[model samples]
Target: MPHFFSHNFLLLAGLCCLLPGPQNTGASDLNKKRESTQCQNFAPTITNISLFLLQKAIHWPEHTNLVFSPVSIIAAFAMLSLGTKGNTHKQILNGMGFDLMKMPETKIHKCFQHLIHTFLQPNHQLHMTIGSSLFVHKNLKVESKFKKAAMELYNSETIPINFKDIQAAKTQINKHVMKGSYGHVLKVVGDLPIDTVLALVNFISFDGVQIGEFEAERLDKLEFQLDTGKVVTVPMVKRQGKFYLLKDNTLSSWVLMQPYVGNIMAFFILPDVGKMEELIQNLSHECLNSIHKRIKTRSSNLSFPKFTISTTYDLKKVMNTLGITQIFSNRADFSKAIRDEHVKLSKAMHKAVLGVEDKQWEELDFPDLHKNLLPDGPSVEFNRSFLVILKDITFNLPFLMGKIKDPKTK
Candidate 1:
C-alpha cells in the first residue's frame, strides 16, 4: 500500500460569517454569476465524475486527507476520448456521466472547451493553473483532427519525444509536471515502458491566501484526535465568521462551506463520530446537492488543525474498475489519434499536492522570542519594563509543533 501524506492546507477557520463590505460584496456577486454561468447544464456531469473519483479514493487505506483535481483528471480523459473509436469512445463518455447517443459529440466537446477556458481566466486573489500535454513518440504521426482538438479545445501542447531514450523521456515528462505544479509535485512519470508510444499528462495547481487570514500570534498548539484514536499535538488556528452550515441527518454528517477570494469555495463534510464508514458508503451527488440546498448562512466559531498534504495514485487500476478497460488493452483502437503504428495506453498516473499556510506567518521570519520576552533584569526601570514589552505578544503551552509559514508573501 502507498503511504499518503497530508498535503492539504487545513484552514484554521471552517465556515465563518460573511463580513459586510461593498467592494467585497460586489466581487462575491460577480464570482457567483460567473460560476453559475460556467457550470450551467454541466453541473451534474461534473459532480458525478468528481464523486466517483472521490469514492474510489476514500477506500485507499492510510489516507485520511485527500486532494485531487477531478477537473484535471476528467479533462485529460475527455481529450483522450476524442481519439478513441466505437465502443472505446462510448465507454469513455459513459464513465464521464454522459451518454454518447443522447449527447451530441460537438456539444460535449464545447462544454469541456468552455469549462477549461473559464477555469484558466486570471485571478489575482486566487492562483489556479491547469496544464495538459500530449507527448507522442517521434515515430508516430498524429492525425490533424486529433492534434487540432487537443490544441484548440483542451489547449494542450504536443511534445514529440524519442521513446527509445526512456531515461530522457521520463526526465522530460517529470520536469514538465514539476513546473506545471509550481514545484509542489516533484515527480509524476516514473519508469516508462520501452514501447511507450504516447503519454497524456495533466496538472492542476492552486494557491490562495485566506480572505479572513489567520492571526499568527493567536496560533495555539493543541491536542488533535485522529480517527485511529491517536492523540497528536498540532498547531491550531481559530476564527469567527459567518458560514453556511447544515446538519445532514440522513447522512449523519455536518457540512460547512467557506468562500475564498474568487469563485472557488471549499466545502468540508465531516462525519459524525464512529459513522465515517457509513458516510463514505453513502456518498452521492444527491447528498451533495441536498447539503448545498440546506446550508444557510449563520455566525460560526471555527477552529481547526492545519496540514500540507500530497497524494499520488496509479489510476490504471482505478480506470479499469470504472469500466474503461479497452483503452489499455492490446485491442485498443486509436485510428483517429495516430495511424503510424498500433499503440495502446500502458499507464495512467497522477500526483497532487495541497499546501495551506497562515498568511501572517508564512511570509514572516521567526522572531527571537526568548530575548524579546525577557527583561534585562528584575530591577529594570518600570517605565521600560518587560511587562510593557510583553503586552504585544501572546504565548501558549508547548503542546504540538509543526512548520509555520508567513502568509503575507505568495
Candidate 2:
C-alpha cells in the first residue's frame, strides 16, 4: 500500500527508523547530512527496495520470507499469536473452584494445548460414578460461595452478641499490583478461615450478594476463640488500601436513574455446572423455572472464574468409563489390596450414587487440567477476558494434561 504512493515516505520512514544521531536542522547539521549524504541516501533505499522485492516474490501466493521483517518473524515463529497472560480463560478457572465451560475462538496452535489439558484432567471412565464430585462442587454458586455456605454451616448473618466473641475484622491485602495481570492480591475473600483471597476469588467463583452475605455471616459465626487458631481471610468491598466498599457502577449511576428503588428488579438464571447444581437448587429459582428478581452479573466482567470446561463431553464420557475400571478393578488378583481398601471405595461409591457423600463429605482431588488451554503456556490477556482471537472454532485444545503431579496434601 505505502509502496505505490509514498516513494519518499517509505524512504523517509525507514531513514527515521535507522537514523542513529539526534535530529538538528542547523547549518552544521545540514552540512553533516550533505557530507554523509551518499551513505545515508543509499542504505534505507536499498532496505525499502529489498522489502518491496520480497513482497513481490511472495506475491505469487506462497508464504515465504527470505529476510525476516519483525512482523514476519513473529508470525513465522508462532510467537506473536500467544498473549502474555500465561493462561487461557479455561486454564485460569479450572481449579479456581467453578464449573465453567468457555471456548472462545483461539488460534490453531493454542487449541491443541487446551486439548492436552482436558485430557489430563481427572475423568470418570474406570470410576463409573464420581464420589469425589462430593469433594468438589457441581458449580461455583455452591462450593466457593462463602455466605450461602456459612448460612448452611451456621445460620444467621448478624452475629449473636455473646454467642461468639468476635475479633475486630482483620483484613489482608497485597498492595503491589501488576496491571493486566492477576499477580497482585488486592483484597481479601471467603467466609471460612480459609487462605482464599476473598473479593477477587468470589468475584471469580460466586455471585456478589453471596459474597457480601457470607462475609457478614462468617463474621457472626466467629467466636473469639474460633478466630485465634484459624488462618482465615476475608473479602473487603474496597480496592487496595481503601477503607470503603467499591461502588458498583450500575448502582452508583442508578442512584439517580432509578425512579423508585426498594431494590433492583431483575431476573437472572445462571446455569449450573458441577456441585453448583445443589447450591443453585437451594436458592429460589427466580430465573430458571422463572421468577422476578434483581440480577447481578459478576463484580466486573474481569472477575469471572473462567472455565471453558468442554461442552463437547464426548471424550469426557468415554474417559469416565475408563476411570471407573481403573479405580475399582476386582480381577481376583487384587485380593489383598481390594480387601483393604474396597470397604472405603465401596462406601465412597455408595455415598456418591445415593447423594449422601455430598452431605457427609471429605476432601478429594481431581486430575489438575490447565496446561491445555493454549500453547506457549497461557496466551496473554490482550483484552478484558484475557482471550486470544481466532477465526475458526475447532474441537481440539492446545495441549493434553502432560502429567498428573499429586498436589501437596494440605
Candidate 3:
C-alpha cells in the first residue's frame, strides 16, 4: 500500500514526508538580512549537546527506532538561560557544552540567535520551523529584561496565560505548539502539575525531500530482523550510485551516507553480527569524528528499509543526568529573568519528527557493460541485453544511526 501524506502520520509516525511543491510559501525570510557568521563557530557546541543527548537516549530498547533534534532542545534551553543568574546560568551553559566562566553569556545568546535565524527561517529548499513559548500564570510578574531577550534573540513568542485553569492552559499550549511546529508535535504540555507556576516549551519540525528519490517500481517487501530476533517484513528501496562509504574494520562496521535535499545527511551504520551492542556502547563524539575522517566514496548498490520514528523527551531528567540541577530546583536563581521570586522552572518539554527516503539520480542507472569494458581475468563480458544479478545488501537488525544537518540554499 502506498503511504498517504498527512499531519497525523507526521506527528505519530515521524516519517512519510509531504514534499513541498514549487510554490510552497509557508517558510519566512525574516532573518535573511543578517549574516549568520556567528553560527559557524557556534554550531559545534550545539552539535556536542546533540551527541550527548543521543548517547543518553541510546539506552532505549535496541528494537525501537529513535529521532530527536538537539538543535531544538538547545534552542529551548538557551532561551531559558537568558534570564538565569549565578550558578543556575553556569550550570545550564556547562550542560550545553560550554564553559560559562570563560565564555561570555552575551556571546552565547548572540550565537543562539544566529542559529535560530539561520535554520528556523524559510529558505527555497529546506522546510523547517523552530519556535518556543513561555507560559506563566497571569498573577505572576515577568521581568522585562528576560522578556525582551526572549523575543528579540530567540524569535520566541511569550504569552501570559492563567495556569490556574489547568484544562484551558493545556489546550492553549497544545494549540500553540501545534501551530509552531506546523502540526508535527501534537501535545506539548500534557497535564499541569500541582504548584506549577511556569512552563517552557520548545518544538521543531522538519520535512525534506531526498536529493535523489528511489523509484516506486523498485520498492520491494523484505524481511527485517529486530534486535529480539523477530523477523518482520518491511518495504525496502534500492539504488546503485556513488555515495560516501567507509569500512571501519576497527569497529567491525560499514558506514553508508545518503544526502537529503538540504544539508541533512543520514548515516546508516551496520555492525558485524554480535558487534552491534559493542558499537553502540562505544559510540561517542570522538569515535564519530574518527569514523568520518576515514570514509571514502564509491559506487555500490544500496538497499535500506524505509521506516519512520518519533520521540518525546522529558528534558528535565535528561538535564539532571547531564549535571544541570540548580535550574530545576528551588535554589534556582532567576532574579534576572522574572520579577516573582517564587517562580522556577516547573516543566521542560521537547518533541521532534524526521522523515527519510531514497532518491535515484541519473547516475544510479545500471552501467552499460560493453561501453565501460571489463577486466580480462575470468570476468564475463556483458552487452546491453546481458543480465547481471546484484548482491542484496539489507539493513535488518543491529544498526546504529546518526544525522548531520547543514542547511544550504538550492
Q: How many collisions per candidate?
A: 20, 62, 7
lDDT values for all models: 0.54, 0.17, 0.53
If both were scored by TM-score, which would come out higher, candidate 1 or candidate 2?
1
Better of 1 and 3 by TM-score: 1
lDDT of 1 by residue, 51-142 (tens): 66655764544344455556566677778888888777878778777765666777777767765664455541144556677788787778
What are the TM-scores, per candidate, against the unseen true structure? Answer: 0.74, 0.15, 0.73
Write one digit per residue (lDDT tens) for candidate 2, span 130-218: 00001111111222232332232222121111101112111221111111113322322112222110111110110111111111110
Order the candidate numbers by TM-score, best to worst.
1, 3, 2
The candidate scoring highest on TM-score is 1
For model 3, the local distance difference test gives 0.53
Poorest stretch of ten by lDDT in candidate 3: 383-392
Tens-digit per-residue lDDT, 1-410, candidate 3: 42321110001111112233233333334453333443344545655565556667655433244555555566677777787888888888887887656557777788667656654433422544455677766766688878888998988766887767778888988898666555656666666775566766655444443422322224456665555565566655544445566777876766665553323444566666667656655655456556556776665455555544454555677677678877776677777766645445655554444454445422244544412312321211110010000000110101112321110100
- Residue 255 of model 3 has an lDDT of 68
